[model samples]
Target: IGIFMWVSSTEASWQDFRKPCIAVVDAKTPTTRIIRAVSVVLLPFLVGFLGYNSMKPSTDEPIELRTVHPAPPASTKVHGKTFVLQTASNPYRVDDSGKYSDKVQNDYKDGNPWDEKAPQFLQYVREGGQIFFQNCHFCHGDNLNGRGMFAFAFNPIPANFTDAGTIAQLQETFVFWRVSKGGIGLPREGFPWASVMPPWEQHLTIDEIWKVILFEYWHTGYYPRTWD
Candidate 1:
């Protein structure tokens, strides 16, 4: 009777539970359905997000914040007839007459003993030419004709040293003064323009200045007579 009951129960359970459907559904159909669902859900978001980023306008980053404080106004005072200052970049102009004092011109003279001999003068010219070529050639032409490469860029243009009249009129002391003090200390009517001629007095020895003076004189045919 027990064996019979057990068999009946087993049969009941088997009838209640159907066998698993092992019959393979078309794999392509389910795969396509899953792929379609994922595509439908994800494609619009991916495309829209990428498109939005691409369409957004570019913006510059903010500049660094800063504070600026300008320097105080410069002080001025007259010393004797001229003004002295902490910064010599621009000296005080004395008169409105556009003339600098002779005191300033006298300041440039070195009082070197002049040699009259041609060989000595020639030697001075050669040395002066070398120095001028090394230092001044960038602004003054190689032949001293004032056609240097830098002359083109100058607003007032460099003086034409080759002009006989101009060369003859220029004093050696005047040349030395211009070289020593530069355009800043020059009379308003003299240089009358800005320049890059540095204060060569600090860099060149007194003898070198005389040599350059002699060289310029010789180059412009003022030498032998002017050397002394």
Candidate 2:
């Protein structure tokens, strides 16, 4: 009777110990629940900040923004040559001014006349140089030496303006005429050779043409002696 009683008591004790263990397993609680929740909330924002920093544009720390001023007007007094001052917006009309006409007879067959003013001549040179760079630099080159970027592909290469002998031989009127009319066989001439010269009469005024001419003349060392 004593042995039966001891066995029943032992079995009851074991049952009592197992009950708490089973309850614990059923609860299924994580140890770091609070930490995990905080991490999940902040992770997206942290990742986005890092990505934005990587993609940010670089700064130009040392350089400052600058404002450019418009260039002053150019003037010249080459006796037979007329210099007109007009903007690109108000181009001269061929009908209103005899400067540009389709009539071959109106072409500047005579060369430019010599002027005697130094100050006016210098101003013309400065203005002409700027115009040449803006319009003719792509094909005529910055030095007016004719080896422009596109000169190689051209069948008849652009004329070298720096060649003193050549400049001496060429008349000012011829230069103006060529610039006004452009090449004949190339694309400019509406032919197969592909001259790239655009007709400036539509875009540039007669005064602008004169300015360019003055610049070319001064570039070749022909400074004017008078201003009037």
Candidate 3:
């Protein structure tokens, strides 16, 4: 009990000493007092200026989110009656038939009907870039080199689109199909590595998917094969 009282009295004495010491320091002037006083007056303005500049958008940021058109809102309505979203098991499972047995001969669904001659080719590619950054950049990297932020997590890393084996040799149709179907569409050969690619069909329209493909080719400087 006495020890407790002594500690309490000692703490009180220290507090009292600190109050007077603080006052003494405040009373005296240091050599840098003027500079400190000026700084204190200007600190808020300095902070405001820096904050404003920092908030301004960067020109070099890969994608501008504000200007990009967001994906269409999901709707369950089919007719003028009660609305319901069509739910089914993985669609790929039902069509296990040789989907790619005759790749060259097969009439693979081309997402983007518009070709390079189209006036909106550039615009489509630009929009596709925004989409790629939003959806694919995490796993495909900013350069689409497959060394993305999450690339290390996958057993077999994401395909490097820049490689000759990837977008260079493959037809746009194959690329489109693979992207739309994603990991679920992986055949027996693509199995066991644990692909993380998600089906983009639900989120991206066929045209949007094709646009991104166009961006990949243009950015990588690889030309698609001609039917000739």
Clashing pairs in 1: none
Per-residue lDDT of candidate 1, residues 93-205 (tens digit): 11223343323222222323234532333445567777888878778788888789898886555667777655566445445556665555444543334565676766776
Best by TM-score: 3
The whole-model C-alpha lDDT of candidate 3 against the native structure comes to: 0.58
lDDT tens string, model 2, 50-79? 999899987855543321111213422223
**Residue 200, candidate 2: alpha-carbon lDDT:** 60
* Candidate of highest lDDT: 3
How far out, in Å, is residue 34 in model 3? 76
Candidate 3 lowest-lDDT run of ten: 85-94
What global local distance difference test value does model 2 have? 0.51
Q: How far out, in Å, is residue 194 in model 3?
A: 4.1
Per-residue lDDT of candidate 3, residues 9-53 (tens digit) = 777766765665465446456634655555666777789889999
Ranking by TM-score: 3, 1, 2
